[model samples]
Target: LSLHPVSVLVLKVNEVSLGIEVRGEDLAVALQAEELSLQQLGTVGLWQFLHGQCSDISFQESSALKTDHIRPAVGLRFEAGPGAAVHSPLATQNGFLHFLLRGCDLELFTSVLNGLGPFLEDEEIPVVVPMKIELLHSRITLKDDIPPIYPTSPGPVPITLAMEHVVLKRSDDGVFHIGAPAQDRPSAEVPKSEKRQSAKEQMFLVPTEEAFGQLVKELPTLQKELRETKQALADANQEKDRLLQEIRKYNPLFE
Candidate 1:
């Protein structure tokens, strides 16, 4: 995959504290055509929108902190690549698959920071302080395979796969759970009366009865105005056609 231009909001490194922080914004990644072997995936291409923030990266003394962990908020998306779905367990009805991630928090632990002790003698590497991360909302969509148009044309490609979104939320117990794709209770558990009331409450928004009555009263007038506008447009078109015909009679080039 080829990397596109990357832009960051802020980048800071503290030599005294032996810490580094990077806050990125509007970062993009892309894969050009024929960059990878297409024998298995067939003319694959990819574009990524990294619109999430990564903040609060610092190194601290291992003993001062409890455990070394990194959790970051993330918003990332991948687009138009069959290679992305190679490891997916789910099957797509169409030939393409789209992936979307929103509102996610990821946490992981590692000892790589502490292993850097030999590089920096004066500064102590932290073995316990967790890395903090934040990600924003993003989506990836797949388009229909249109050879010759892709990797050349600058126009937008048409999407083929249905977009599926997943949201991660931390519960009160501090464990992350899938908030979307909510489970439905058994139909037998809900009474018919309650179901009817719920349906009534879910009605779409509409004009108030008084406002609707007013509109009804002026319906004839509105219809008359619409007809007048259409007539005027027709008259203008006729006039334009007459003028063009006259020009064609005089100018052989126009004819």
Candidate 2:
């Protein structure tokens, strides 16, 4: 496992009132198992093993206790190697797993305050504030390795199982709503079927060896076209310079 950079801040209104804030840039986690067996302990055993593996791990970074806002993690990824093996109890094959989460931003706020005591009677009533949390522009992905069926083909190809943007907001009523962000939603003039098709296009992706080979073969041709385009632009610039010089010769005051 590797982390790029992280920071944390905590805010304390009083001894009993506090909020925690955390931020991070990038995080990568990896697991490898040659022979994993947990038949004796059941499902709880898997959690125990994972906890034991990560309990004492720590990161060195500076933190302060003076903020009231929390930021979401960026560029988070989790991967399992192909060599991993699961024993009988779990009933899972020995393939690879990859998960990615990116572009996340989160905000949460809560507090305890007094009700309208000054405007009403003299007695003050404590009111528990509602907590609000909002998440914006987050994307998640899960992929698994697909074994090759033919002997002539290359190794396995990773196929995406799930990928989509998620937007969630919890209002003061404590009801969570899921929907697309306002800016990301399709225009009002677009047809409903078109919008549905666009959404379907974003969900699935499959990469094959034939497509990879085609892309490799086209690379040289693409490079050649790029070079020709650059040469043409240079020639056009030279011609412009010559024309400017001729105009300057005709009219010296054209500075």
Off by over 4 Å in 1: 1-205
* Candidate 1, 62-132: lDDT as tens digits: 12112111111111222122322221212111111112222222121212223244446656542221111
Model 1's alpha-carbon lDDT is 0.32
Sliding window of 10 residues with minimal summed lDDT for model 1: 31-40
The pairs that clash in candidate 1 are: 72-133, 73-133, 73-134, 73-135, 74-135, 74-136, 75-135, 75-136
Each model's C-alpha lDDT?
A: 0.32, 0.33
Candidate 2 runs further than 4 Å off: 1-215, 253-255
Best by TM-score: 2
Number of clashes in model 1?
8
**Candidate 2 lDDT over residue span 133-249, tens digit each:** 223233222222233587788754433222245544333344555666444676984445334331221111221355447658877997999899999999999999998899999
